[model samples]
Target: MKAIRIYEFGEPEVMRIVQVERPVPAPDEILVKVYAASVNPADYIIRRGGNEALKPLLKLPMGLGIDGAGIVEEVGSEVTEFKKGDRVYGVPNYLDGSYTEYLAAKATQFALMPRSLSFNEAGSLPACARMAYNGMVEKAKVQPGHRVLVHGAAGGIGSLAVQFAKAYGAYVIGTASAHNADFLKQLGADEVIDYNTQKFEHVVSDIDVVFNATPTTTVDEALRLRSVPVLNEGGIFVCTHGVWPSELFKGLLAKKKATVSMAGVDVNHHKIFTEVAKLIDLGKVKAVVNKVYPWERAAQAHHDSETKHVRGKIVLQIYQED
Candidate 1:
């Protein structure tokens, strides 16, 4: 099998396609032939190295993808939900390193691919979709009448968050560049605020749930969201990026009580992925793939995702859908 492995962490070029032994499934796992994989912010972050805090989440010389779509090549004896020929899409594991020709992981982290989508579209769903689901549905528990605000609403995870919140029956407000206003509207957002020309805080108020999908690790940006006055009482602030627990809420929580949650904990849970698949199948949500690249050029894929201006997800076709 072939995979993108890095001997040392640095730039995208450090990742090279190398020959590696095929992985075998565990008792509760399945082995999937990689058809397509998606590039994410985490792929580039881990490649650059030295966020030692994430060492437990990532291993050196491991594969470089978070999720993918493929046909089930083999399954473990303990797995009953999938078969050898099943068409599946899912995160190979909760941690990083899924960029490869073959991957093995617990069967619970995957679900049947939506009939309406191709391998490339299904491959784009798992990681980002699950992350969005967890943030909006699980953590925030957004309700029907709630007003939801999605920051970075044009990016991969943010786009999905907007749709999920809308599906949950909330009035979705997305903040993006003016160019993406129509794109977000098509995804069911009731309102789109252009972050460049207009301030989101001034444009919208009393949000019940604020989905912050910006991929930043700093506390600097999170501080500006002192949304005490902008959010209703008990509003939920779901931050997908790394956050310093105490610094985010110095004076913001004094007046109104709000829960500040950092997502990505159970993002790869099997049940959530299954639900995401169902949403896609019902046309309640759609995958947004901005670019597609051959798996061999994964380095370039990483470069594009790192740019952070990509409208949606970037996919890598490891094997063409035939």
Candidate 2:
């Protein structure tokens, strides 16, 4: 087997492909022959040594990816949900890494890949789609006829959030650059606000649910604060990046009787993946792949992801699927 490993954290150059022994499945696990894996912002963050609190916990010579799609090569004695030749896609153990020729992890971490999608597309959905599903459906509780607003609506998570909101029959509004306005609409956004030219807070109001999918930054923090006032009374605001400053935003939220929630991806939630797979197969949702790189070019893929301008997910093809 071969895998992407980092001996020490610094630049993307730190990641290297190396020959490694194949792993055997545990009693409740499955071994997948990986075809494709997606690169995420977290990958670059881990490659850059992560933050201060996360630095010491990271071991050297670590694997680099979190999600992927592939065919099942083998299954454990106790695993009955999946068998040999099952086509699956989902999160792998973060420490074990998905940027490899083979991945051995608990069967519960995966679900059937959408039959309508290709390996590259399926590989791109696990992490981002789960985050979107958690925020819009589980946290915010979006419903039919609601007016939903999604920030960073052209990016990986936001794009899926728009589709999920539409699938639930919500009227969707998205914020992105002017170039992606049409793209957002094609994804079912009823309205598209160009964040570069017009401020979302001024243009849209009475939002039933506001989903903030932008990366955390000083500017985005301020934007989150501004978004709260636009929500209708009793509306929900879900932030995937992190929670805003409660002290500053509490008064505004109280005035509107709105609630704020922080969303996190649950990698072990097989049921959520199964439900989402149904949506994908039904054409209610689709994967947004920005680019696909050969697995050996993982360093280049990380460089592109760090730029923060990619409209969707960047994937690494480990093995060509027949």
- Against the hidden reference, what TM-scores do the models get? 0.94, 0.96
| Clash totals in order | 3, 0
For candidate 2, list the clashing residue pairs, or say none.
Answer: none
Q: Where in model 1 is the C-alpha error above 4 Å?
A: 56-59, 94-96, 219-224, 247-251
Clash pairs of candidate 1? Answer: 63-97, 65-98, 65-99
Give the lowest summed-lDDT range of ten residues in model 2: 241-250
The sequence of per-residue lDDT tens digits that candidate 1 reaches over residues 117-193 is: 99999999888887799999999998799999888899999999999998889999988889999999999999998
For model 2, residues 166-281, the per-residue Cα lDDT tens digits are 99999999999999988889999999999889988888998999998885444666876889878999998887864355666767887889888877644346877898999998
| Worst-scoring 10-residue span by lDDT in model 1 | 219-228
Tell me how far the alpha carbon of residue 104 in candidate 1 is from the true structure, in angstroms, after superposition.
0.7
- RMSD in angstroms, all models? 1.8, 1.5
lDDT for 256 (candidate 2):
87
